[model samples]
Target: MNITLVLFLIVVGITLVITGWAARRTRTTVQFWAAGRGIKGWQNGLAIAGDYMSAASFLGIAGLIAFNGYDGFMYSVGWLVAYLTVLFLIAEPMRNTGKYTLADVLSYRMSPIPVRSAAAFSTVAVSASYMMAQMIGAGSLIKILIPSLDTTLKPWFNWTILGTKLDPSITLVGVLMMIYVIAGGMVATTWVQIVKAVMLMGGAILLSFLVLLHFGFNLGGFFNAIAGVKDSKTGLNFTQPGILYTYGKTQVWGVDKALLENVSLGMALILGTAGLPHILMRFFTVPDAKAARQSVAWAMGLIGSFYIMTTFLGFGAATLVGKSNICATVAPKCTPNSNLAAPRLAEYLGNSFFGTGGGEFLLAFIAAVAFATILAVVAGLTLAASGAFSHDFYVNVIRTHLLHGHVSEREQVLVARITAALVGLLSIWLAARVGATANAAALVAGVAFVIASAANLPAILFTLFWKRFNTWGAVASLVGGSLVTIWLVAIGPGWSAPRPGWAPNRSLRRDPVSTRGERPAPLPYIFLVSQRDLVGLIALDVACLLAAAMMLRAWRRRRTRPPLVAAIFVVVLAAVATVLVLLGVTYSLVVGPTFIVALLVIMYTARYERRVTQR
Candidate 1:
């Protein structure tokens, strides 16, 4: 009976209708996987933005900026700027080569079996990691949106199912994602993304407008308001950077742990976008390379504009809602999660407009938007994963290799649907088992971004420009890089931390030991990659790979290595060396081996990788 639930139902109903319509038309493999490659520039662009701008950005960035200020904007800046890499390097090449999945491009020249197997695994790993974070976030939004499940329907909604506690909200999220992907395929997912993107962008703009309106449309007044508010436990100054990044024990993490973390996360954003399977899959939905390029432009404009507005949204949350109200408060407080900052602000805005009823209605609307964001994003992730499973693994690898056959279009579509359902169920189970999983979910997200940057991006760059990039290097880069990323992450604080506890005390901390920034002997890359350090290096690797590709292109095509490309490598390498020196020799020795080994492997493998003369 809650207004939020009603609005949510309405959104669901509409999407399901769209899904049904899409299903009838989605008979062809091309239509199911790539929407028949017929989407318009603007349409596909919006869909790309919709798919890329996930629930994490919907409220996570706003809340971080709300509480963490300059540091939080680091995520925003990196994410928006990342499109440049996508536009410059990925979109056109992917459109030219890829058919349905990213593996299509990866396996274009190489033996399809092993290359695609690695690509498929990498895609699914990244997607699942990303999906888990969104699912965790969606679970949190349930209480606000329904406002009744935790109370009136508590008994019926909360129960154990298959050894895991089944919250109806979490189950509903999985079910909806399944419906979107299974019912309509890429066409349905595309339309769903478009709808959610419009809704999300519109809601963000409305919130910003309302916030600015309250401050007499003066940006200075709004800034002053946020700077004025204070908290006791961790008094946050929205105007400052060190509050979250350089404070307390975090300061000991490094002289500039905050800076390094930001830069690292920035790297992940830039390169990860280029490598993310779902986003690349969007390029295939357009007609050709030109459409792909234009769509990237459209997506860039839209995504860049959205990020800009997040500044207002973030500051508004700080000035209007306050951190204490958002978390670590006693009674009558909004949910103790920063992710609720935007929704809480929405509720307040509604209260200002039409009293309690208006507030409730607006709150419901925002909640619905939030869920729609989750549904759309998860659908994209599921599709990308399923494409890898059905198209790459099943069709290209399994059916073609062992059976000496190809899956029918209908069979491929059916396989994709079933895979989508399976992934959704798995995510649902994972989300259900996690009690207070916000921190862990964020950790998973970071891992995904890193894997994409370190593993997938490297493979992509090598595949496109490196003529000598053979199946051996392709397999090595995909499999080796991913394993290394996972190894680093597994050894880091996230995977090592106990599953049951999620509080600051239980999590990796500003506490005395971690602050010292020394690796416990057990954690090899603990100090080297840390969490955010890995972020910086991920970007560095991407830049380095791009630089290498450029160098190769110049040497082969222009008959010499370009000085500019050489200069880029020098500057990036020197910058990295500077970071290492700043971190002291021990940190360098512990983690520096990875780059050296990777370089040596690539060089050694290049001999076996004959250049593709025709390509």
Candidate 2:
């Protein structure tokens, strides 16, 4: 039997055993969703680290650094720093207040049903996008290990599956993911994450060590090699910061579009981790506020160390394997794939150190580890999605509104298991239908991060700390932010423009960055809203500041009825402005005004509640 096949079976068998054992104890809602809150801080911390470091961190970031160089390392920086937001602002407060999902926190002071519905929708959306990216990476990695399997199955299952031919590897990955979540629930999922985290950290550490050994453990030599690395096609050193982010022939206020895009990506990443439903859900599995805080502390250390090692994983591939081999300039030659960089590098390093046939063993181990990474992440995402639906939507919304107000523990657990299976199936269909290319997994996951940051972050912060935040503000932030973020992504340069020579399929929609003959397409100006007159931009910013002043004044005199109607008028004005801005207007207008309006609405609602109480 092939080494990769043997390792794959071993990995699958161990996880299944864990699932079987966990299923025995998973008899109630708490066990199914929160692991009965018996998990120790270190255990949940490892799980959080495992859940957070998905295929995007392992495969996608490594490939990005291999190809894009320094620009790719920004992802590592942003993601590592993001845990601060969680530690100081979100983690303890969330555990102290909420039960299962992010909706638990938001629905604390607001109307339960509508707020829960909005939150559930956003959770599902983020999870679906994030899950699709992980599944695609898994399928692509699997295809590499067992290329013959896909070809063998293609003859019988050759019909179009979501417009692209079905690959057996994708189906296989999806089936295993469903099994993990359906059988073991959070208990099984938590242990699987703990196991995978150890495997991944070990693999990463070994790879980094070998890379250092190749350079004779000299930091200067390694840095020099990376600096002198050449682009496969253009021969430019991609190790420079601005290389990949360059926008084509487009400037905003004479500023490079690349800079703006970089900033935008950074903001999304830094804020997104605090808002991720899967990461937030991990907090509930621990006992209390102190456990939650300890877990975050442990996670930050583990996550930081892993991200630091990614520098070695990425640059090692670039210098040792060469970019041309990782992503060939010519068609189909050199095995032309970026997603396989880390595994391929493992093969090379093993051969160099241990001689003939050792490459296969190392490659097999890394491949199994990569598969475990994907499975662990997908399980967490599916659980979070199901929890949102079964707990928030079904129990809180549907049961409260239509069915009887009370729901039994057994019924909720059953509903959650059913929902997990359905969500897994839907994700499989979407991943197969889109046929997302493997190398683009990080960017694909970026879509989820952006949505989470825009929609969930604001709502979470307000609910936890802001005293005046109410149902209307919660609904607006969740629904409005999600819709606007999705719209912006749809029209952005990434999705709207394609490289000149590529086919016009939706699969190739992202602005192509090829080492081949094509250059990136020009960005649409409407998407580059910074090009609006500089004076007008400053004026709108000033107006935003004035709006802040008004909010401060309203806060000081909140008890009086005189400014109550005026606060309502400001909210109405802000709403009208938001409508106009959303209609073919500059994007900057959206952020400042929308935030101001949400605050104003909170103020008005708080005053109204006070008046009603007095009457």
Q: Which candidate gets the maximum lDDT versus the true structure?
A: 2
Model 1, residue 245: distance off in Å is: 1.5
TM-score of each: 0.81, 0.81
User: Which 10 consecutive positions of candidate 1 have the poorest summed lDDT?
Assistant: 605-614
Clashing pairs in 2: none
C-alpha lDDT of candidate 2 relative to the true structure: 0.81
- Tens digit of per-residue lDDT, candidate 2, span 521-577: 334333434445444544554564566457557656656554555555555565555
Q: How close to the true structure is residue 112 of candidate 1, measured as C-alpha lDDT?
A: 81
Question: Model 1, range 76-189, lDDT digits (tens) per residue?
Answer: 888988998998889899999989998899889987887899899899889988888888877766765565644655665676768988767777778878987887888999
